[model samples]
Every structure is written in C-alpha cells, then in structure tokens.
Target: MEVYYSKSAKDALREMTCKLIEVMRAESDNIPFNLALSGGNTARQLFALWQEEYRLLIDWNRIRFYWVDERCVSPEHEDSNFKQAYENLFGPLGIPQTRIYRIRGEEDPSKEANRYSELIDQQLPKKNDLPHFDAIILGIGTDGHTASIFSSCHFLLNDIQIYAVSKHPDTGQLRITLTGPVILNDTPLLIPVIGEDKRKILERLLEARTATEDFPAACIVYRAASAFVFTDITI
Candidate 1:
C-alpha cells in the first residue's frame, strides 16, 4: 500500500490524474485497458478534471470502462454511478458505448449482479480463476465501507462470485458490487479518500496489518497487488 498526501481535494485529484496518465501511457496498444471506477464526490471531482484538461492526455479509444459498484436505480437517476461517469467523463471525452460496460442498476438486484459477473468474465483477464481488472478506482465510505461492502455485510469478502448484491447499511438501498476476490486481485487499486471526515477511518485502515472485517477498506489495501491512496486528509 502506498499513500500520497495532498493539501486539498483538488491537489489529491491532480496527483491521481498524473498517475493515471502514467498507467494509460504504459498500456499496450494491442489490447484495451480495463478500468473499473467507483462513484462519489471524489469521483465527480476526478471526472471534472478529466473533462477539463486531462481528457486530452488520454487515449479514450483504448480504454474500456467498468464500474466497481452501482446503486439500484435507473441509469438516468442522479444517484447512478454510471450516470455520473457518463455525463462527466465518457460523454465529454466522446467515448463510445461499446467500450462502456455498466451494471444494469434498474434490473433485479440478483439478476443484475449475475449479469455483471458474466460481463466481467467476458471482458477482464483471468488470474487465479478470478477476473483481474487492469485498474480499479475505489472510495472509502466514512463508515469504513468500500464498494458497497459494509462492515455489516462481511459475507461479501468471502463470496467467490465476481460480483454480488449488497444493501446500504443505513438506507437498505440495493447495490451491485464487485466481490473481494476480484477487487483484491493483481490490479492497480487507486483509492482517493478526501476530506477531514475520512481522517480517522484512514488512520485505522493504515494501522491494520492484514485483511480485517473491521474495515473493508483495509482489506483492500492489504490484499490488492498494488494499492495507491491519494488523500487530502492530513493523516
């Protein structure tokens, strides 16, 4: 696990963009770069950067976009992760629909989960019998959850399925999320945790030495092949 501290959210995102550009440039031209993205205020900020100036630095045609998780809502819904990326990143970059693989959040939770699982098998490279994403961007919830895998839903960490259905601990809202095996695979896990609200949780995660049920975000950093965290929080 590696951490990059920035003075503000904007600076953290700028640092993240610089690293992403390095990954993009290093990718093989013969194959598409599979990128899994998470949604939140941090993601919105990152998308805005890409839309503003960073888009020119990326080869959108060689990138295939996927979501780390999605709320069970219509694609047009304001809460939809795919909607956020489409409006802010994909649409602005003129990325084609064929390169976008989004979880069908409006469908039945179980069915959508299975569908997305199959999509991962079909799209991502296989490693150790699990689909390995090239790069996975994620966010840590203030409650210590990541990718809809709340502390209350620890079974998701043991789930062998590529993707599974989850419910928000507080709202009971359904969500489709990639399981632990896929997330902890050999991929570049980029986590940008901004704001002072996340400071304590980040500290707890950093203190943990192994994958623990207490903090789902910690399990990610401990198990992922390479985890990069960019945070404005001073910790």
Candidate 2:
C-alpha cells in the first residue's frame, strides 16, 4: 500500500482523474476496460470533475462501467448508487448501455446478486478463476466502511463470489456489493479517501498495520496487489 497526500480534496481528485485516464488508456485495447466504481458524495465530486475536465478528451467506448455496491432501490431512487454515477459520470460519457453492468437494486437482492455474478462470469476476463478488472476505485467512510462492507460484515472481505447481498448495519437496507475476492484482484486499486473529516479514521487505520475486520478498508489495503490512496486528510 502507498499513500499520496494532496493539499486539498480538489487537488486529490484532480490527481485521481489523471490516474483514471491513464489506467483506461493503458488498459483499453482488445476489449472494454472493466472498471468498477464506488458511490458516495466524494464520488459525485470526482464525477463532476471528470465531466468538466476530461469528458470529451478520452475514448470512452473502450470502458465498461460497474458499481462496487448499490442500495436496494429503484435506479431512479435518490439513494441509488447507479443514479449517482449515471447522473454524474456515465450519462455524460455517452458510452453504450450494454457496457454498463449495474446491479439491479430494484430487483430481489438475492436474484440480483446471482444475476450480477453471472454477468461478471460472462463479461470480465478471468485470472485464476477470479474476474480481473482493469481498475477498481473505491472510497472510505469515516467509520471505516468501504462500499457496503461495514464493521460487522467481515465476511465480505473474503467473499470470493462476484457479488453478494448484505444488510446495512444501521438501516437494515439490503445492498448488493462486489465481493472482495473478486474486486481485490491483481489490478491496480485506486482508493481516494478525501476530506479533513477522515483524519481520525486514517490515524487509527495507519497506526494498526493489521487488516482488522473492524475496519473494512483495512482488508482492501491488505489484499490488493497494489493500492494507491489519494487523500486530503493529513495525520
């Protein structure tokens, strides 16, 4: 794991976008570059940056978008992760709809998990039986959650399947998230955990070299082939 500190959140996101473009350009060729994205207010900020900066410059046809996790709700729902990404990024890119493999949050959670699992099996390239994504970008919550993997949901860290369902620890809302064994592959992982609000969480995590299930982000940092953390938080 390696960390890069930006003077501010905007600067960190700017660097993140540059790295994302480079990854897409380098990885996209024979097939659509499989990219999975996490959802949050931070992601919204990044997507807005992408739209304003590189929306027209890149060949978006070479990329396929996937969500790291989604709340169980209609895509039109205000809380839906797909809605967030689509409104901010995917909609602006004008990529083919076929290339967007979003988990159906409106469908039965179990069925959607199976469907997404099948889609992963059929769409992405496999490395030693696990799907290989070109890039998997995620964010960290102050409470140490990443995607839908909360404190008590330690099983998600080792879930080898493509996707699985979890109940939010606080809300009990069903969620479909990419399993760690599938997303934490050999591909370069881009984790942008911005904002001054994350300082305490970053301190606790950095002080502990171990990946505890208590803080799910630790698992990602530990399992990824190489992880790059772009952040504004200073410790």
> Which structure among the candidates has the greatest lDDT?
1
Q: Write the per-residue lDDT of candidate 2 for residues 19-41, one digit (tens) a residue.
A: 87888777637777888888988
| Candidate 1, residue 36: how far the Cα is off, in Å | 0.3
Candidate 2: Cα lDDT at 37: 88
Q: Any idea what lDDT model 2 has?
A: 0.84
- Model 1 CA deviation exceeding 4 Å by range: none
Pairs with steric clashes in candidate 1 = none
**What TM-score against the true fold does each predicted structure earn?**
0.96, 0.95
For each candidate in the order shown, give its overall lDDT on alpha carbons: 0.89, 0.84
